[model samples]
Target: MVNKNAGDIQSLTRMNQLYEKLLNEVDVGIHVINEKGKTIIYNKKMMEIEAMASEDVLDKNLLDVFMFRESQNSTLVKALKTGKTTKNIKQTYFNNKGKEITTINHSFPIKEEGRITGAIEIAKDVTQLERVMKENMLNKQNGKITFDTIIGRSQLMETVVDEAKRATRTSSSVLVVGETGTGKELFAQSIHNGSNRSRAPFISQNCAAIPDGLMESLLFGTKKGAFTGAVDRPGLFEQADGGTLLLDEINSLEPSLQAKLLRVIQDKSIRRVGDTKDKEVDVRIIATINEDPLDAVANNRLRKDLYYRLSVVTLFIPPLRERKEDILLLTQAFIDKYSTLFNMDVKGISEGVKTLLQQHNWPGNVRELEHTIEGTMNLIMGEDVITIQNLPGRFRSRYQAEEEPLVQGDEGDLSESNQTLHEKMTKVEKMYIQRVLKNNGHNITRAAKILGISRQSLQYRLKKFGL
Candidate 1:
């Protein structure tokens, strides 16, 4: 029995030696502190990360060795005090030599027989990662808008925004389908900004803007001497590694390029236009199509396989004509915007101008409306309110052309309209409300805004009308 006990002790000593050797050889920094806050074990990687020698850190109090602000909030100290564990905490601190170090730390308490004896921390340095992200070209684009900047109160717009916010929580490929000028890129930017990869690059490429001959090299990179004047250059896929790539108007790509894109997405690697080797990339793809994606697929403009791969998450933005409830809200926002830009004191739109705006169809969507307001604001000399007379000539002509025929028909139909004034007005109101609701895809919140009524009031009317 004594000989068996002696053999167990020998085995324990050998196990401890192996554990110590394994800890020292790991790439991540490892640190251990006793319950008394004394450094018990500090691996070689930890020494290199802190730029300190073994003698300086060994057997020293953790607070005394670091002597920095982050020491007070150290995960190791916190774990020791609370007998709890903390994982994946990003920390930054200045070491003893006053050099800044940033790391992601995972710390846990060391328990012995239902009591906390010490704590161990494993840290991964991320300073170099930050440096590499900042060097990417996509990070250089200025005035990038986040989800916060997107403004819309209409129910249709709210639904789109909600779906977009949900998409940000994943690494799945996103496909945004909308008409031209429906703010597809804006939605793409919002998703990118809200994602975990926000700190990395957000490179955008309009597939239609680049010709087919050069598109391959521009997207997948090229080797030196691949073609005349072609030097070795990383493409958008390589540049956007660890980030997001916005492929605008993806349907414009030829079917062959679409096949290549699918392979890259499936294989997680790409071969340069003329290179024999394949390069791996970690990039999230956010594709935008200016038309209906299903229609594009049916028409063979987009590859079916590629469409399915990119459409793992899809967001559809309704056009301005379809969501007319947002027109006044957007108009007010634009007025504020151009007011600041053109240095105007315009505060509101006249009732007549508002009626005219509601009657006209905004075929070009939000982008067109913004430009219209900007142009009008530039022409306003000192008006505080924009009246119908102040509107552009083209807009006034279009409004007159549509209104004249409507007025003429109404005059001719008065003999047939024998109902009381109150009855006729109520009938017109109900008809208009129904039309607005249909236009907004039966979204009550949006229809309410178009009808200038509260949601509760709209609901009451909807019930009263049996709609």
Candidate 2:
């Protein structure tokens, strides 16, 4: 008595749902377009990569959303037209909102019975990674970074910096722990620059950047016959001999590699892949993790013994939200840095923009703040002030529209915000000193030592700021 096609329809619906799940669940962005250049399938990651919604992309023309009518930059279009596959191609494009996004894509043409039907492209978002690489390159080019290169003045930051400065005097393996974008590498570089190995080669690698198979040789060099196309080369450990080797995101390393790393730290030597003999190398290892080292060990992401070996000198960089005093300071600093770089007459941000920046929890920390300013300046046009209108959608979406921009005279929001930053710093200092005093039970010398200041200076500040 059932409909004849009921079973087929049910099967089809379930298949579509499974297909949808496959597209969305993958880590990489996926996009599929028909022969006519119309976007037929766009997955969740693609939406994140392009910063567009399903309504804006689904069933829309590719050229209309991403490029000019005849632009050749779209990989989706290229595969469709050529009926060929393009692998590991880096493409740079602006989204519908005009924000620059860079992705590494592998595009394949969908063919049915030897006829090209459509094309699918898988993409990995490399926009932030590219930006970070550029910044690291700049730091290396500019005589490397020191503690002086860091840009935080909050009490927590000051404490961390003081500890890091002390750590620079040691030859022990250091673990720099922090959330993503909190500048752990910066601290590593600073420690190296401040140490006696300042002139020696300082090499760094993000453990999460490469595949597990390649990571072993990357750290401990490979012999000529190590594997296919392997050459006799010095790895990061050998390259960083008598200097520093910074392993960023060390928790991402495989368990076997972690054991190897621990052995290397203990033995002060490394054995190249496919080589039986080990040679001594004097390399100061500085490892970074984007979480609490204890949590990393507890979660089995990091080995406990390896954690102890690396944590001989642990430096924890506070996230941006914990040190809110640095927000406006960083905002104005980035505004100035980018203004010069972009050759724009941009001066400052508006009060409403400041409210949004302070209100929003900066999950990505300082790097996110810098990129926010950079992205804002990219589209600021000829405007001197960065009003709320200049912010990206993620920030703007939560901002109230009715709020008016408040600028004091011709001074841009940034220059005016300097005073605001100073005021906020003073408030934070007052609050911190009070808490320290309370915690130390109002012992002036103990609180002063804890604050990294003289008791006299603490008394002067306490009275001067009426704390």
Candidate 3:
């Protein structure tokens, strides 16, 4: 009888150990609380998810330990009180340390002989999962263009491209300076693709797109309990490990955040929002600015220190107006692209249309040219060549305005003796302003730049002449 009892005891002990091991090995967090809300069991996975140890929670009241607001409404409490199961319900709350936690929970009442005993809650950490999905989407949308598709042959553009190619040979940070729509992100991606880390991820984020409050955590990561609803998750720096991170519109970042960015660049390490330890990351940063970076620093929009670190290899992408020689080349490339995309018979732009295109300054650069071509291709049908009629309304109006004669009668008839000095001067000024405006695509900023006047001054003159 004694031997049989010993064998049975040993078997039960082994069974208990197996049960404990299985519970801890599972991915989901498991917690069991008695009918009185006292914690009865908490698995190892649960401890890790909560950023706590098992000893801290065992045999304690759930309400006392977590202090979850409105414990009566909690899934575990509700399941125990109502004797009903809550399956796959999503919950978000702040833990004791004020960190945000999100989880999909399944809570069930533990019963014996149809009597309520306790409640068991199973939670799956979804904060990390959601972050991973967001990063994956960004990766899918980046690195679609390469150097070969850049499509510019002007000396200014050639220099920019050459400098960009040279930048890819090293791991130093690159700063691309250009106006909006000048393909800064494209250059950044090309550099990444041409680098040794081409096989790794290429992540791009517009600094202006994210709110200032969330910028720090988004770029440097957040530790569990960093703030209300904060969860342990990797930031862009960590996500771009062994890869490239493109920060578009770096000047838009708040100055305080810029200082933090400088530290990250200098140290090659980032500490999560609530973390005490620094994590080393091997990421190549490529920052872009739409405005002159030095001007931005002078205006207090960007930190000077951050600028120096990021501009290790600055590549200045010339505005389309500055690279006028490449206008036809870019236009042809865009025409071919849109024609193939729309499955249209459009062969090319007419000489008249080409002349009109060359006359107008492209404020939006290559992107604007591509959009114009795409718009024209969508409207063309049964036509081999794009003409003035196929152009956008703005272009058509500008062309018509240019085509109109300056004076109603012959120039010889409207001699200097026919008008006063002021009248003749006013007429000439109006004509000159109109010509300048047309040349600059009616963009006040570019027109002002070419006219050697302030944009506000140009606006005043434009209003005066109604040009």
Candidate 4:
């Protein structure tokens, strides 16, 4: 009888261990509370997410210990009262640092021998996903904004945001450098909006747009007879006084104009056409260049002195290919915008369409993606899915060929026919084991506990799998 009882105890212990391993392997965070609302069992992720230390969470009130305000009116409490599973409960809680965090919580009543015990709650952090949702909300509210309206979110963009934020606190000349369609104007607008000069006028001028002969008159105020086009007109520099002046493609200006621009940036003064005297102006200069200013200087296309004056704080934006993550984000944003404009119920791109979108390199970056989405919507009909078939011929050709070749075996049998089937499933099993290890941040002891296996057993498997 003693030997029989020992065998039964060992069997039960192994079963319980397996149950724990399954729970911790899940991506979501889970916790259990007793009838007294005290946390009895919780996964490592649940504790770590709440910034708790050790296994001290056990036997403590889940709410008081975690210091979570939502626990007071928690849906988990409601689940415990009614003994019903709460399907979806959304709540936001602030961390110790006061940063708001949003999570989706699902709770189920725990039962013991057909009697209610306490409750189990699962929470998933939807912060990034929630941001996408909110961005969609904002997009619909303001349809006028396009990819051109917002700055990028790449590391380059993050640096630009940080610099713009810092620049807002001070008055400095900021130079934005990038290829055409790189959203230099968008950065300028963001900087202006973030600055104390937001209320002030934000005037912009394209130095390359104006004729070389009328450049002086267009930049500085002119007397009545200053030039053929001038009739007592105040130039852009004076018009942008006490505000920001965005000089688009500043490198395209003539070398003489570059010298004049340098003088204005240095002295905060400008000279009108046919007028020798200078007038004081307090405009903050922000310039954009599509080419390297150094190359322009070396080629004698731009003045060296002016390049230094305008480039006090230089920002370089990488092309779209370098930041592929932003491609789909910008694409979706544009699609949402154009959908409303065209008055179509076209919801979104199909999975195949999305795959094709990612596979091809976006040469034109955000601008090309925007135009492609718009063009696709216009040419395609109905509320049907936007498939790769609907894409432009040029874009479609990029993914026309098969992605991967099928494998074949000897005797004309398909390679899959000779597969080991269950044996070959080892790859997936090993992958899952490694994922669990990673989820536990490679803490072997904790991973073993969560996996419901002895630490020694887990170590043995790790060596067998060479993980």
Candidate 5:
């Protein structure tokens, strides 16, 4: 109905092109969510930070793409709800691909003539940087976690730790394979600290959190005039030349770029995005994968040749469920940490809470346990010990589901043969004691230490069990 001319359309298209260039050129991530929590605009840098395609994110509810624990857990969602600015906040969440992503974000509401319209968030991916930078002061204010900080008493963990310590002795490329929250970056930082390059820089980047279109330039740097507005810049490799460069989620990188990365690793040199010549670099490469490297290789997510090269020194961190013995120990450590920080008198957890914690599968691994304790700490109301009531509702429900039979008449599964509660508990205790004993090579003191019981009590149990 309105008069629309070709020149007006051309001008509008040019303005859109300019805006698009701005979104792509900026280093920081930009995400704009509508009032309804749907993504209206997600820029290239945001794509890099989230490692999501525009088609995957745009026009979809932000909550659908991310597995944030709560609806308010999303800064953009929170901004929309509160209509307030949130700055310098650290957010940890799981993406659709199941990779854990951590970011430092600044979020604020966007308004049109004093009326709330949508929310915008500027983010910097700190998925691995949070380990070294220790920037997440929002919740527990945790700092760098070194080898000494790693809590591993189980044989599986001890073996992995010993192998990681050995990798520090050499600068050979190391591949740390583990699930999310298993502390792959923590091990990487410890390796760097123990290595000869401790004094130099330690840089970390999550390949899954970066877009492949910008991956090459970010990793290999760019020269002036490489494109319009391109400036001569040093890539992560050069910045970490004298130190360690940790590439988290390495398999997320495109195959073409992976091949280039392989070339750089092989040659110890890198060619900038537009530079004609290659510059030699001395960097210790450490790469991590959330899933099994073999699975990644088979799925073609990771190149087989690159895997072989980078895995010259490989370390696998077992998930939390595999080593339940560490759960209580880690819980206490977290309690001590948070209590010291909050100055709360939370000395210990109740027996019921302990049973529940140990019963939990901890799909998020150690990180989940840490946060569970942290969240519980915030709920403490002059309680000396944490109880089942203090746990989050979801935790309580899950624990209940595990303890009770889903069907009312499934008694055979739990109370088979009309066994008494004490007898069943004692059976579980004896089984655990035997497993710990075998794991510790039948060492009494060592097993007792792991079990958090006195050596005398352990001896008494052994005598009673006739083992």
Candidate 6:
């Protein structure tokens, strides 16, 4: 009897301490009601949070003291009715100031002899969460990107965007080969954004910019005192583990380093510079080569083994000259950007300027065109419209001659038009196929890869065309 009495006293002391902690230290609002539905135990903070005094709530009928809207559900009532815990019950409750506040309520029933005695209710403020959810819904409704922020509407650009989205669905390495200014980085970013690894960090390194000696350290990282001026640092591969690492100008990698890159791609692991310890990484590699990678391999500038591994899902972006329809669309976008930055009131491009833009062959592609327009905007102060007179002098005269209509003699020269549509298609197909084949140095496997098709499919076509 003496031992049982001591144990009872210890239990009572612990319960009292728990009650005191809940009343004074807990952050959430807590309320306890008796079998008669009258307030038996409630926290001072709960009253202060509701902007009411203890006298206004203590010993009062709990249901009568608080007002609720008809739409608002009661977890405490449900807990009492069902004799179970109700979790994450959401509703809006009006404070003493009559302002509606959102909350998530949790409640549990107290029972004795299988009969419901009372219910304990706890409320958590969720106004911030509610606002965040609403804003996310609005952003979704607006059809804005939650990832890549690329903006373009041209059909060619759309195709590139679609390919980037498709690339994200696979874990295979993607090779984006394009001209210097054809938005290779944008495509890489879009692929990362659309991927499952978007939440992780995305790292980009320009292989052409880094020195041969430090390339390995930059890519695979190094330990402290691994070399001169070397502190312990995680390399791009370790930093981007479970995410993506884009190697821009990959063809520029030294032949020695290319072999190392191939091993990383094949094994999905890395060994830091001067460190014998090998570490496993799951980095998704995306490489961009401005030049023909196969040509680099042929000249012994790039390793053939690494070239094959990095060209898993190859995508080639056509130059601006080939996608002429996108020129005006990209022009307007660049104009809008420069207009905002330069604080100009320039409205639109004139008819003459449009004709000249359409006729000119953009050798430098999109980047050159944007720079030219930006330079033109700097020269003109107040503009009714951007005319041919405002354009760069070299483009104005050379391309201006191509815009004029030809005479009857020129119309009769239809030799170029006399070719049948089938013949024209064959010509285009042969040219593109030959380019791919030559770029891959007659390696059908590499050619098929560069063209983003199967080797067997290429073989069938090559046999059909007698090439």
Model 4: CA > 4 A from native? 1-153, 402-467
Superposition TM-score, candidate 2 onto the true structure: 0.58
- Measured with C-alpha atoms, the lDDT of residue 166 in candidate 5 is 92
lDDT of 3 at 65: 65
TM-score, candidate 5, is 0.57
Instruction: Give the higher-TM-score candidate: 2 or 3.
Output: 2
Q: Name model 6 segments beyond 4 Å from true.
A: 1-155, 400-467
Which scores higher on lDDT, 1 or 6? Answer: 1
Candidate 4, 371-443: lDDT as tens digits: 8898888777654468787888877875676755556543232343223453245445566678889998999
Tens digits of per-residue lDDT for model 1, 26-115: 999999998888998999999888888888888889888774463448888889989888999987675675455678999999999999
The TM-score of candidate 4 is: 0.54
Steric clash pairs (candidate 1): none
Candidate 6 residue 447 Cα shift, in angstroms, is 13
- Report the poorest 10 consecutive residues by lDDT, candidate 2: 410-419
In candidate 6, which residue pairs get closer than 3 Å at backbone N, Cα or C atoms, i.e. clash? none
Q: What shift in Å separates residue 107 of candidate 1 from its native position after superposition?
A: 66
**Local accuracy of candidate 2 as per-residue lDDT tens digits, 100-126:** 678899999999999998899999999
Clashing pairs in 4: 21-451, 221-235
- All models: lDDT? 0.82, 0.84, 0.81, 0.73, 0.84, 0.75
**Error at 424, model 4, angstroms:** 40
Tens-digit lDDT track of model 5 for 223-328:
9999988999999999998999999999899999999999999999999988899999999999999875766887999998999899888787877867889998
lDDT of 6 by residue, 1-467 (tens): 99999999999999998988868688887877767777676776566556667777768776676657787656666676678897898876654444445678889989989898988888777765766676566547434233245555666666666777888898889988777887788778778878898888789999999899888999999988887888888899999999999999988888788888998988889998878889999999999987655556668877877877877777777667567887788788777666655545467799878877876657677888888889888767567378888887866667644334533452242234324564456557766898789888999999998888778668745643446
What TM-score, to 2 decimals, does candidate 3 have?
Answer: 0.56
